[model samples]
Target: MRELLANRVKTLTPSATLAITAKAKELKANGIDVIGLGAGEPDFNTPKNILDAAAESMYQGHTKYTPAGGLPALKKAIIDKLARDNHLAYKPNEILVGIGAKHVLYTLFQVILNEGDEVIIPIPYWVSYPEQVKLAGGVPVYVESTSEQNFKITADQLRNAVTPKTKAVIINSPSNPSGMVYTREELIAIAEVAVEKDLLIVSDEIYEKLLYNGLEHFSVASISEEVKARTILINGVAKSHSMTGWRIGYAAGNAEIIESMTDLASHSTSNPTTTSQYATIEAYNGSQDSVEEMRAAFESRLETIYPKLNAIPGFKVIKPHGAFYLLPDVSEAAQKTGYTSVDEFVTALLTEANVAVVPGSGFGLPSTIRLSYATSLENLEEAVRRMDNFVRSKWQD
Candidate 1:
């Protein structure tokens, strides 16, 4: 018999966005004019200063392996950033850098989760959270939220989802897909329940610096000392600095938990690229101008696109407080088009309108779709116009 892949590997589902992107590519290859809005990436270049740092490191021969946890100076820079930006003190030893925020999250799951342990994940979560937990032999308990509450679950929801097997709770604010930022009061209330349940907190703050409309991002760890001790704060320079390819992400938490995650990293994919570490150090410590410039651009795009998209017949768009994505509730459109679900609606949009948007089924919200406005303003306007025509022609039937 042919060799079989590991059962754990088989448990993973293919990324929904990648699937849609691949189909878009196939259509484009056949000379189709497809507007890809399904991506979760920032359409910006790595800043010049950070690129220069990476090049300098290469010339300086810093390509050798440093440590599994990461280079000392890079870790120190992370610690300094945590303190300076988030007002949270973290020792260098408490910080571990990995290939990306996703990498760091997977490593943490492998280190802490045992078989059958349950991870409390908010529904409409990032696509990888549940799959990562399952890969680590844990079960994911999803807590659903509705658009009425801006797609955020209440504290009571968390309390209801917990059980004796609960191990961790993930909090992603300025969240992917929905762009929902939890308020300080909301976070504190969630922390109270987590403390009572003795659950670990995985705070994904990758979009911390991408807030719009003057909304601030609060680190879950910064709420209280007890929460800080229990939280593994995950952040990276990807969304904020348009450094997605640099592949630098880190987490800081209780020294023991951090050490365990670092040890796990030691055995698997030891230290992330040395050059990437050096570049990330520059990103964390260098000028704040680039971040501000990008944030301003994103805010402007939001202002322009929100009303435009909302004006489309049968389309309902939520005003996101942060991040560059707008998740439109498209169930009405689905019903109008006789599509029955968002997945079918998105497929029809792609096939007929040449617009690629990710269906919400992957994020546990089956009646919505996510559109990334990270593209140029002209492209955003064109995308909505094309989608509007498609809805009016097809949905009006």
Candidate 2:
């Protein structure tokens, strides 16, 4: 076979979290008692008001393609959201709405990166980040952030990671695998580095509204106009309104970046689904009760399950402030259970214990595992119990 796949595609790594979640689903399909804690989306339905708005939009004939940059109305709603929620102001030209925050990110990378340009990605990143950077012909420079630092990169570390090729840095607060939120002071410090170094800040705020335990979401762009000028803030209704399937996410920042992204989107995706855009307008402009309700549910589940998961033999975890995931360092548990690696332990958990979680290697942390608590509390507790027992059964202690 003459070399078929493109080099960029060949270099890509599949999402480990999705791979394991699929395996769990496959096992369940075969009548195995598998409980998957690897899911990345909320278990709740999209709020009724948003659904109603979508239906109404179609009735009002909003089923056609919208402006590639997104409708002006939607942009206004997004601008309002920025001002109201994050104390940031943006005009329509500075916002680019695309299909989900994930695709919005892919578009941004494509427009910004040149061959061999480097993007500084923190350890414990979302599974898709480094891969997307590679697909854009950019190199990924990883900055390490250990569990001891709560899985957040320090400003000094970021400064050290920057090189002439370094074009941007990604900051995902309420981080995916770790669920850690950056403090306001931390953002200010990072923003200073980004401004000084003239590095673009790619801020992923998808989990912005899903914060917990009195923790407030802080947008790094809010630090100052200079910081905001160099930042492209990404957010969507997926995590906030349980609209994962709707595929509506937007980026706010420099007018030039937004225009390039919008132009690329016009040719690539045409536009985000019209119905979804209409729904999202309602999501931002409509009542925010359901948003808070879902946040509360996630918080409750975190409080209920954190202690149980931490109590598991040989598992060490830092309590997370936001997001619906727990990243527990299980290197000791993996070793004590006679497994050579966290990845191997994850497989055993699926086939032997009938519980599935994402191994942390995909997030650039090999000795840990990421478990999402987005499932029902009953399921969450039961999965932890199975993991606890599975470790004990193979314990060399």
Candidate 3:
């Protein structure tokens, strides 16, 4: 029976983010008091305006199918958003909506990739990027970044990784796991390289609006006309609007590329949920106080967690510039605890401290671990406290 499965699926691995969440749930169900720091979702409910819009859509019998690209009105909303918020102009026809940013990414791979096409993915990326590339019959060429560089790949590294078969590069600013937002200068440098090498850029800006301090998130499409012509700007309301369950994300790019993505979506899932499409229109066009509130909450949590984690004797934490995560290099913790690897250290932390964190090895950094602060301040405080105690008690040379 197992042999009957398709060969492609046999090689596929589940998303580490979802896997960790599922394992945490299983532990909780068995009466263990597990606190999951693995989910990449906001701990907030959908804004009231979004909820009202969804209800109105349902009332208007919008339960029927929408155009594959997206509802025309929703596409316009996305265009306006790009122009107003990100200083980039886009046509409605250039927008393609998907179930989420994940779906938009998967569909991009499906439409453009052929066997052996390579995509340059910077390390400490979102957990799904490489796997999606693999599933799309492309090879994921990972370029490693270290904590010293703020987990960003250098232009020299980008130049070295490109080959004739290279099709695209996934640039995720305000990145998941690492929470490092690439600066405008850094993006300009990468865009210059992409233009020289003629590589397509899939800029995942799902976490764009979650930036902290005075740090700004620059859209790759806004870098230059050359980049705008070659970049796919992927964003959504999930992280920004706390609408993860609503499942609405959109991409803007060259009309031809977006047309292909829309066609693939038309055949695959058709339009994303019609109700979600309606709610997302409100997300884009409505008042954004809710978005600001969520951003403020994440900033406050970062303030609380960053120092606490760094205070631990052996733990080294990089202050994430954006997103709701902290990537602490815990190699010293593993060495002191006599653990063979970061994975073992993670297992021991979960078992001893009842705190579930996604190990950095899963995101391509074997010496660190990733923890999402998209939870309550109470939970973050308690989880760090428990982890500190567990390290002090059990981790000795």
Candidate 4:
């Protein structure tokens, strides 16, 4: 059986985040009071309007498959979204919808990458980026960014990392794990480097609508015409509309690249869920009050828990402007608890405290741990209380 597996399949690593979440769930099934913070999804339900739209679509006989890329109405809604929200213009041909943003990204890599092509990924990236690149026969070249820098790579770092083999650079503003966002000025500097190096930009804006504080989300493509031509903009309704199970995401970019991705999707998925496509059209064009409510809820949680997390002994964290995660430096905690690695510390936390979190090693940082605040405030409060007690019990003083 091992001999029959493809080389790609053999080399791939399973998603550590999902594995941790599953383990916590298993414990909960056995009546353990586990407070799992490993999952990166909103705790909110899909808004009633979006649900009503899906039901309406099905009731109107929209259950059939759509075009492989997406429905025209959805595409147009996405176009309007890009223009209205991000200040970027696009035609329907410039977009390709898929099962989700993750699938859209996988398809994008498949279409753009050749054997051994290199993609520049910053530290603390989404868990799936490197694996998706590997699955496409592309090499992931990681650039490390320290916690002191808020886990963001600089233009000089990007310039130094680019080689002749480098095909693209991934920028995830309002980033996952760390929840750090690159400022518009920072993006301008990186865009200058990309333009100078003639590298493609893969901008993953899945968390764009989840921004907090006074921060703003900027699209690298909106910087200039030249940069826009080289940028692949990826987004979806999963984060915005609480539609993770809806499985609708899309990409917009150079028409040729989008067309190639659409063709690849046609063979791979045929089309996104037809009902999801219709639901997402409403997600885009419908009232955005629900999106704002969810965003505010996440922001309120961050405001509450971030300080509590920092107050825990040996846990150092910077307040982040956007997203629902906090990647806290827990090396001191690991040392005090007689663990050699953060991964070991995470395992101990789950086993002893029944609090599940993701080790930063999966996101390319070994000394930190990520806790998603996407769950209820009650769960977060209890999880942190357990974490604090665990740390105190292990304190050497």
Best by lDDT: 2
Q: Candidate 3's residue-wise lDDT over 1-397, tens digit each?
A: 4678777778776777788889899999999999999999999999999999999989989999989989999999998989998999888888998999899999999888999999999998888888889889999999999888999999889999999999998899888888899988888899999999999999999999999988877898897898999998899999999999988898899899899999889899978999999999999999999999999999999997899999875799989888898999998988887888989988888887899999887898989888999999999999999989888886676
lDDT of 1: 0.90
Per-model TM-score, in order, reads: 0.98, 0.99, 0.98, 0.99
C-alpha local distance difference test of each model: 0.90, 0.94, 0.90, 0.93
* lDDT of model 4 at position 73: 94
Distance (Å) between predicted and true CA of 70, model 2?
A: 0.9
lDDT for 139 (candidate 2): 95
Q: Model 4 lDDT vs. the true structure?
A: 0.93
Per-residue C-alpha lDDT of model 2 across residues 320-363, encoded as one tens digit per residue: 98888999999999999998999999999999999999999999
Model 1, 52-170: lDDT tens per residue?
99999999999899899989999999999888999999888889999999999999999999999999999889899999999999999999898898989889999999999999999
Off by over 4 Å in 3: none
Candidate 4 has its poorest 10 consecutive residues by lDDT at 1-10
Q: What TM-score does candidate 1 reach?
A: 0.98
RMSD of 1: 1.1
